[model samples]
Target: MSTANRSVILAETPTAGAAVWTALAGLAVAMGIGRFAFTPLLPLMQHDAGLSLVQGGWLATANYLGYLAGAVICIAWPPAPARAIRWGLVSIALFTIGMGLTQQLWPWLALRFVAGAASAFVLIGVSAWVMPVLARLHQSARSGEVFAGVGVGICLAGLTALVAGMTAAGSQATWLGLGVIAASFALALWRPFSSDGVQATSMAGGARAPLTGQAWIAALCYGAFGYGYIIPATFLPALAHEAIRSPAVFGWVWPVFGAAAALSTVLAMRVLPALSSRRLWAYAQLVLGLGVVAPVFAINLTVLLFAALCVGGTFMVITMAGIQEAQRLGGAQPARAMALNTTAFALGQIAGPLTVSLFNGGLKLPSVLAALVLAASSLTLGLTARASARSAESRQQTEIHVIRDAGDARTNPRFEMS
Candidate 1:
């Protein structure tokens, strides 16, 4: 209402606590509008652009390869947060726009690879760069919503592509135009991105405590999560259409999945109160696995929607919570802990598509078998959760002993006489 209040609201709303989500939304648009949008528009593009299915798929793979590379860079460089963020933005813009700038398969493959690399950086950098500031800025519960921005962006891009299709044109060139728009999306993020009013320091002081034994378990669990949810996140809508043969109804599902994730995060805040990130993450993974498994048996579009509502919705919560849990177990070197988790997640993601490809588009018994493997790995969460609890208990005991020893010396008669 008042001037100061207005300024405070602006400072805190999109720009505070979970501002990285806002930044992520922009990156998501840059990353998703072209990458995910391509899947929906692939048939049209293949026909109009004179592209083959194999080549088009390769383009997608190239982007993913680049994304993996970006993740590697993120894990390797902990001291360069701002630099990473800036480079990520630049790479996103370049690769996103590059999608529209060229049409040939060779050139497109190069750009898609670039885009994938940029997207990976953005995802990894958020954990490496923006998360610490967010944790200190807002309640742990609120950070859950930040990861949902990917869904929001994905949904938005999907909706954008949908609308662009509904237009009389519905041409593949429209995809290029969407790519053009994506190129500028990240530019809006050029301003200083602060989380909960904390300017991100390129490097924070005070070394993080070394990760506990449990930390590796959490990393492995997070990695498993990467494999479990990505298939649904990336392919659910396509599956919806293929299974039900209704792109219109099915196409809208991914956004709902994104919205589901966004709302679930806000909901989890009301339910889970502590910084027990490992438990929250494991819980999310458990939900995610069910979400993934449910639709596999879905007889209709409604089944897919239910799966989206469950697993698709909780993806961000698991990711944010995993990062937090690792931070909790990690004593002085959170950067290193984060790096470990980053590496594991990257490995899982790289494995996701390859594993799915082996399924041959879920044709035979192999697809169902692979899905079962993912469902089983979801239990990795429970293992990590137990590890986190043990680590927390150990930390509490250490602190209690420190306090007790300090108190005993203070109370000793000799010290008092002196």
Candidate 2:
């Protein structure tokens, strides 16, 4: 290739990669730090911040409540995706740092609520904005690459806590440190999320489509995945702490969970390129169901780790597939559809801690709920398949009828006589 050709090729190479990475960074701050920094740090809060288990549960609920509210607002009154992304990232950084500035319970609750809302806005906004660009670039498969940020963020949060633990930084210092990190990432990603850079695509028919039955099924399954995963995710360290009573060992559970999650999404795309998003989603749901029940059968550290691997590995991949399916079903208005799924997911997260609290045990009621929802999700897939088949059959019959009518008209005796 000539020098100019080489320069053009080199420039094109970075465009897709840069877009993907920018998205990755955006999600890391919005999701990894804003939404989930609390999970790994929950144990830390108990030790240093005088946070009770009940209070921690309430805080988790508060965050999800904020997330739910955010999703609702996004759907009811859709905003420009680019603007939402920029403002959401800034809000995430501010609220995350705010968590460290105040140790008061009410203030912490308020900050967490805002952070949760910020995270949801970023998630929905980024998905709305980025997926289309990738599709236009014929990089639809790379959407998984974008969604991998959630796991990356989760892993980074865990690692940060691990480092904090090593330095004896306590919860307050850890919060401050993560907040600064989130702020830096937000500042870096601000450029990519600009209004001029990420133009909103027009939906087909110049309007958003109504949610279909299949879309609702996908949303429900997504919600189930959220509830099922949050239990092990939110409380794994605490569970490990109960068994080992050492931060050294228990601290590793979250990192392991996050590492598996981060890797799973990337691997899933390569492993299942031919797989339909719905099928991938269904299989992931099954795996998550199995993971949820692992601790119920055995309380060993090994079993918990296995459970973490299962839940972490599949949740994000399922999320990616679910969102893609929503877009496929809803068409043109994927953001609206995605917002609904996010709302359902937030509801599931809100319910998870409360369910676990009610049971006061590991992996009993939550496992059952996860399994039941997974089963229902699978059933919905079957129904959709059957419905599709029947529609195909009806189309074939109509075609046959049209052919017969045409033949009869051509063979009419009056026309032959004329």
Candidate 3:
């Protein structure tokens, strides 16, 4: 369809609601099935495909590297948000199906790498396209509903894996199943993400601003968040399996993790309406740190579940807050800022699994290190917020003084008539 026709259709329909739901479904496929379905399927692959922990870590690293590449590409030469999202979702389905068809590690690595890149594109595209529309419609709060899709996607993927485990299905079948679901979602979303469905005013037609010092700091802290949550996010199911030998029982870990993640975004919106995004992000990071270290004290079902709740609960909250903060600071170039943060985040993710592989899959030291990074980064973000507040206050006070001086001169008639 032509851009004019697409605009007319969007105007005739419930544009805001449709955009939000489309973004939600798109994210579910992108993050849930494309990026994280592998996480839940890892143990199954280990069992049926003889995939060792080291191999799994390598697979994860390859995906993260692909994510980094995608983010960098966005920064260098971004495609239109709608176009990127459409193609990204389609690519995810194709690559994911390819995963099911292959048994070789090299092919798996290649497929996963491409899938990872596609996931990044969808994530950035959704954020770029949907957020501006919501803001324009005076429904910025609805963004929570949109981001909640990530958790929903994760939850669905986990449940599918759980079912597969309970029924003694092979990893290949589960992969194919998720791929089909992703394809279905992509098909449904294809039209809604038309190039002219909703214009990204925030992202389009702006002289891009360079990243500031504080922006760089935020990006680095976001990277810390990526490293902080990823180990548990990537290996929670496997960790639970070690604690509880039953697939039926251990499979609950990922679903619980996903559930907490999905719920937390909505709750954060209602519970902390007054909180600043930076503060919210800092607090979530602290909670995530605790979750990251939870399994280290004792590796059991309870501890693992607690860890899942903590990590899953806060990761999405942190993600939403961090990206919102970037948008606030990005100043006519929010997409670029978002991509920079995502690139940093992807680096952290790459480090996380590599850390596990380096330690030979040991959790204690890696968990402790990740926690420390989270703590330190949290402190930095908190401090940055304080500094920004002070800077604004000082500027306001100076402006007030100048206004007072001008008024006094006018009243005194010493400078007004001259």
Best by TM-score: 3
At residue 276, candidate 1 shows an lDDT of: 63
Candidate 3 Cα lDDT to native: 0.87
How high a TM-score does candidate 1 get? 0.78
TM-score of 2: 0.86
In terms of lDDT, the poorest run of 10 residues in model 3 is 200-209
How many backbone clashes does every candidate have?
Answer: 12, 0, 0
- Per-candidate TM-scores read 0.78, 0.86, 0.90
Q: After superposition, how far is residue 132 of candidate 1 from its true place, in Å?
A: 3.6
RMSD of each: 6.6, 8.0, 6.2
Ranking by TM-score: 3, 2, 1
lDDT of 3 by residue, 323-418 (tens): 888787665568888999999999999999999999998878999999999999999998889775554355446656766887888788775746
lDDT of each: 0.61, 0.78, 0.87
Q: What's the lDDT of the predicted structure labeled candidate 1?
A: 0.61
Clashing pairs in 3: none
Lowest-sum lDDT 10-residue window in model 2: 197-206
Q: Please name the candidate that would achieve the greatest lDDT relative to the true structure.
A: 3
